[model samples]
Target: MNPPFDRLLADVLACRHCEALLPEAPRPVLQCHPDARLLIAGQAPGRKAHAAGKPFADASGDRLRDWLGLDEETFYNPRRVATLPMGFCYPGSGRAGDLPPRPECAPRWRAALLDALPAVRMTLVIGQYALRWHLPGSGSVSEAVGNWRAYWPRPAPLPHPSPRNQLWLRRHPWFETDLLPALRAEVARLMEDPAA
Candidate 1:
């Protein structure tokens, strides 16, 4: 049988696998349940999300929620949706933005975590880092996101919802015009699935 959710969550909350390397104390921010139908596979938390101990607690999250056509209550409900970041802890800032998720995380924890979520019907693979690991050699974020049709029933790729990417969004009008509608439709379909 799979591990109980509370027990697994406690262990993950107490993890210190990257303690010595982290900029701050380890605070893994993710939510999951065996019955969830939707999974938001993202990169690590930003400073705001780290502070809140929740993934996607910033503008990026707001935009992401809008894209998925999900309200706060539904999106945050563990039974309805699960969130798993490539890196659980926040990887400090760099010259550009927050640094990439620590390489140690996904290899150490992803498979086990995924196994626990037996009912996940759709996973939204957000950002380049997540896309790299989940959809390797899948080309750039834009390319992967643009080819949303190919990753069906597995995980659909998406650009990070950060406001910093406004330029990219403006340039790639099809993302908003073409992709968001499909993403919302898929999410609605998954939420309505009785098997989920």
Candidate 2:
């Protein structure tokens, strides 16, 4: 029997509702297994990711993998972890970094995609947009991320893993000192568990 998730994914890939609004038409990109154990929810793709048709396929991916204590192979393995952005397509770049993801993508697809990944045990919400969407009423990004404990056993908020934010990382040493160890341990535990 084919799983309903296959159809759900197909529908997402075929989306073109925002085609005319985009500089480039939507190319929704994501990776997951119906039985994935972990989900990495992030902002929209950058130009590089859009071109590559892979999530986080640039320097940002390097930092993210370092944070997770994972290699590219492990991180991209759908059975182990899934990568689904709050918005899937690249939303074009601003003067600084990439523009915010298209608002339409999430409201249209997030719930359905999440519902399809029934085995997801943990969701790592990265960046302000993801934090806002997943952890509503949490106030500022710092406040929401600082209170990571509140979402224990399910979702964990994280700063965007972009080299562009290296200054932020340096200024907030406690993120590495206090959170990285625990985060790594939790990830290790999940990876080690056959049934996870």
Candidate 3:
């Protein structure tokens, strides 16, 4: 790993600033490299991801990879893509679903970590928290995702690619027909040679 990135990652890995507040012990999870061209930002690690010590280690990840037109090897290749979330640890479940990512995470670590990724040409902001942080507005996930072009060529808001959102996917025919084609083409181009 590059020294600066290695240091930043080490710092993140060692972080336990909110361990006391977390339901379980802190276990930050993510994959990244300074050379990455595609940045996939999501809400936070889920229970499966936390246990696996990697981000997106469940059906959600499988769906996410499919959405990006990527296979596991390519999607997990840190040199080509970076997977960072709004929070690094599992925030535990709530009556509705997984609770919102901890309030402290972004304020503490977001900027410094993002700065390490100078080569990221496009950022796919997944779910509400990621969208709020990356593309601030009162707009709902559906609205921001639909208005993706407004933030084109840099950060694009997307609905969470969870199986739970299967209904949403069914409802939004345009996401598949309109946005994904362009998104995939860009990903394919970026994968050819991120260093370019």
Clashes of each: 0, 0, 0
For all predicted structures, in order, the TM-scores are: 0.94, 0.95, 0.95
Model 1 Cα shift for residue 24 (angstroms): 1.2
Which regions of candidate 3 are displaced past 4 Å?
A: none
lDDT values, one for every candidate: 0.89, 0.85, 0.89
Candidate 1: which stretches are off by over 4 Å? Answer: 1-3
Q: How well does candidate 2 score on lDDT at residue 56?
A: 91
Give the range of the ten consecutive residues with the poorest summed lDDT in model 2. 1-10
- Give the clash count for model 1: 0
Clashing pairs in 1: none
Per-residue lDDT over 25-81 for candidate 1, one digit per residue giving the tens place of the 0 to 100 score: 999999988888899999999999999988899999999999999998988998898
Greater-lDDT candidate between 1 and 2: 1
- Candidate 2, 26-83: lDDT as tens digits: 8987998876788999998888889999899999998888988998888989888998
Model 2 whole-model lDDT (C-alpha atoms):
0.85
Candidate with best TM-score: 3
